[model samples]
Target: MKKLFILFIFLLVCNLQSYSQIIFENGYFINENNQKINCLIENQDWKNNPTGFNYKLDGNQNILAADIKTIKEFGVNGQSKFVRALVKIDRSTTKIETMSREKNPEFNDEKLFLKVLIEGNATLYLYDDGNLRSFFYKNNDSEIKQLVYKMYLVGNYSIAKNNYFREQLFIDFKCETISQKEYENLAYEKKALEKFFIKYNKCNDPNFVSNETKKKKDLFNLTIRPRLNSTSFSTNNSMSDTFDIKFDSNTNVSLGVETEFIFSFNKNKWSIIVEPTYQYYKTEKTKESSVYLGGEVIGKVDYKSIELPIGLRHYFFLNDGFKIFANASFVFDFSSQSKIKFTRNDGSEANSLDIKSGTGFGIGAGCKLKDKYSLEFRYLTGRNLLSNYVTWKSSFATASLILGYSFF
Candidate 1:
């Protein structure tokens, strides 16, 4: 749960919101520590959770959000009395990126109900089905106090790292009144509501608002990457029996697709991109035969990899739909090695998991064209993604031409 807040920011930046705006009502202050804590009362932010208020308040009635609202009613005594309210809309908002021009955006809509009455120096109210809800004199929002409650209900889903802290957002609601009791209920209601949202929101996702919203905003995205990746396997020769081996480094070249999601912060000049893809890579390595084969040369190195490229790219725009960029890619390699031919009697050549994590850095230059496309040339070098007994240095370099599509 706590981890969700951290992931919210990363996922929120993935897309640029094209159309999304929340409707907000009057804002007010919630007295705390002899000071006023100002916040929005009735605001419509994105509600990611499905189980929340239906965005509608009966016209005859009113809805007060986390902030405050005041209403007046004439009592039988002919004196003007006040009906104050405090409404709590408990819902989780998924990641929300303000409307932008680039990607699809979503909004969360929620509605709540409000009503109230005053009595003595306290306020009394109905909590659904006429259940008694009370607030005493000392319960004023200005005073400090603590009261133990019942079972805590967790109604929110964990924030996904990819969802951004944009999810599970909240605001406070309050109302002032001429009726002391009404004010009392309003005060305590506001306090409880605020506490609920804050305590829960923070208890689960500490980064929800603090660190998730501020991130590199991507206004334009371009990805045109064609990768030639292949995997090969070797078996049945060294062990003098039967086995399988897959190596992509030396013997295969399969055309694979590479996709990229890019984000820009400094007016589209500086950006970061995540290229998550499945690539087929081929490699050629010299294999020495042990006592099994006496001494022999291997034919191919083939393997498949799910490559996640985290890149930092800087772009320079020229006149008329033209741009230049120099970017570095850090590759996280997840690969499987098997399905090729290997020694039959060799113990090392037996079935094995070739899982490895390697980091590769690549620098590339790209041009943004009129067709909303990009062409890039890059040189990548890094530690090998393969793990082997012999000296097969991961340090390798490659020059590639990439084509990309720009989305804005």
Candidate 2:
């Protein structure tokens, strides 16, 4: 089992290295001199707007990195786009003012790579850095302006928000017949903003339309996993016995099928997962002794069970195609058949032991490649398997290394 686990790790490392290159796609960027340079841009599938990017001119090996200050506009085959813009951002404390002692938000103007959300009669852009989100817009290709919003302490203890974007939109696009109630009910979210812009375009020009693609949040995956399991257990048959029967740690290989339901809301950074898997475990141990007339004894245990693990997982993206994840799960194990067989030195069959079902927990960490394959190491500790023998108490634990291929 150890050798197999080591080989799995080796293969995983090799696969990671093989795909560890910047994914260059056909794209173009406008430089500081306003020259449109056709090149291949490294696509990171960024969750947040990037300050800088890598590009290869004419698809050559020579690469160059450019920042917002050096690039005016950039896009990846019209799938993703960004433009350099000077915008005002609200730097507000997430904590309450009583704890942070911050009464006013800091409004600063900075050059940023704003993601283009909609482009038509009126263009909308967004700047997101995980910590803050700000929106920008331009009318008729005019100077870009930031939609103002801030939270401030009002009176002695109350907090109030100044959502200037609502008034700005109503005044700037009054030709669309936007009502006061409509703008007031609008939420400061991506979907709401996109809807308002689409409505605005339809009001101005019936032929104007925007094509927006959203990623799916809910995912179902089926995985076939081959695992190397290290298991241990101990038992004592009699109270007056000088030596207890101990089964030292042993290794076994098992194949399991797992079904996973992933619920992601924060750009796949955090997710709720429920995975149910079926596995079989079998191992044997032999003991030699002079105290008994038989002189030698052998025990074999076999387990067929299904485990349901419900948990939460967090992912850290290494690049566009690879990520590392950690998870903690509460496992409920249901044993379909758990039996132990014993044999004496004379090759006589003894009574078989039956195990009970129980619940446990597991924690694991792993790396995933292109959302298709994953390798993980998990440790499981759980309730003991009680025996009918008067003095025998047997418990089992396992440490497993699993390799899985996901079918979405």
Candidate 3:
């Protein structure tokens, strides 16, 4: 167990360092001279709009950085695209505590790299800086501009929205097939706006090309895990030393079904996991009694429980088929018909204590192959099985070697 733990720590450090390296993908950047240069650009799978990027020329080991000031445009082929545009943007605070009472938006002139969501006759763009989200648009042969939307405080407790973006869309991109009711119901969000722009563009020109990045639909997964558990248990009575006993560590097999939910952003590197497992521990020890006058006592534990571990996981992608992951979980255990029994050498029961449920924590590191097979090393902290008793105490710890197969 100690050797396996050390090996897990060594692999964890190596994988963490590997995750620190930049991931460069095939992309192109247009310079101020209107010349397009194909190169390898660092792809962070950015959740917010990036101000600058790092790139390397073909066959060059040295990397270079560029921002909106020098680069006119840049794109990771078939993944995402951005263009530098000088436009009017609203920098208003939408928080209710600090919202401006005025209904109209206060616009500021800024240069930003707008992410293209739709790219036909009528194009839609987005600028997000983690805290604020602003959308932009432009038609063929027209200057790009911000779609105005704002939130304001109404009396002391009321709030309202300035939905001027809807009116702007009605006036500029109105089509015979789109009705006024559609415009009124359209939400000021990325997916809603992107869908609306795509529909309008295709309505106007049947040959319109949709350039938006399609998000993945499979965000949840189910996995079956079978584990070999090395478990140890000990108990002591507060008033007597004869009740203290350390049972030998025992090994057992258990099964778990894991449900995982993957987040959409950050290249799908983060996830939430919930695993329900069944585990058991049984061991016996014979000790010479000090108080029983040369008589022997037999101590036995027959413990069985269902363990639920809910946790967060992070993945470091090594390639398309391999990845390493780490996770931490809080475990809640439930046991039924479980107890610790103490008996005399003559086969008469001396004492019996009912086992109670407990809570503990666990940490694990693992590697996955082809998104289907996985192996993990996990250690759970000591849990008190005598929690229901004030005078009796017990500690139970487990180390697991788990094998997983994903059905997803």
TM-scores of all models? 0.37, 0.70, 0.91
| Better by TM-score, candidate 2 or 1 | 2
Distance from true location, Cα of 123 in model 1, Å: 41
TM-score of 3: 0.91
Ranking by TM-score: 3, 2, 1
Kindly report the root-mean-square deviation of model 2 from the true structure over all alpha carbons.
6.2
TM-score of 2: 0.70
lDDT of 2 by residue, 1-408 (tens): 434444554565445434444468899999888899889988776778899999998837998898887899998875678988777666665445432234444668888888888888877888777767777788876788877666666667577776888887887766545667889887878889988888887789889868554544546678788888887676556653423466767777777666666653334466666666676767777777565567867777788787777887766666778887777788887787788777777877654778765677776667889888998977676446654456666667677888989877
Residues 12-53, candidate 1: write the lDDT tens digits: 323212112223323333232334333333222221111122
RMSD of each: 19.7, 6.2, 2.5
- Candidate 2 local lDDT, residue 366: 77
Runs of candidate 3 exceeding 4 Å displacement? 10-15, 19-21, 93-95, 214-218, 293-296, 348-350
Superposed Cα deviation of residue 354, candidate 3 (Å): 3.2
CA-lDDT, candidates in order:
0.38, 0.73, 0.88
Candidate 1 lDDT trough over 10 residues, lowest sum: 71-80
**Over the stretch 1-408, how does candidate 3's per-residue lDDT look in tens digits?**
634664775578567756744679999999999999999998877789999999999999899999999999999988899999999888888887788998988888888999988898999999998789999999887999889899998887598999999999999998988888999999999989998998999899988879866655457889999999888788888987788888888889999999999987778888999999998788899888867644788899998999999999988888878888888899999998999999888888889989997899988888899889999888888899999999899989888999999999
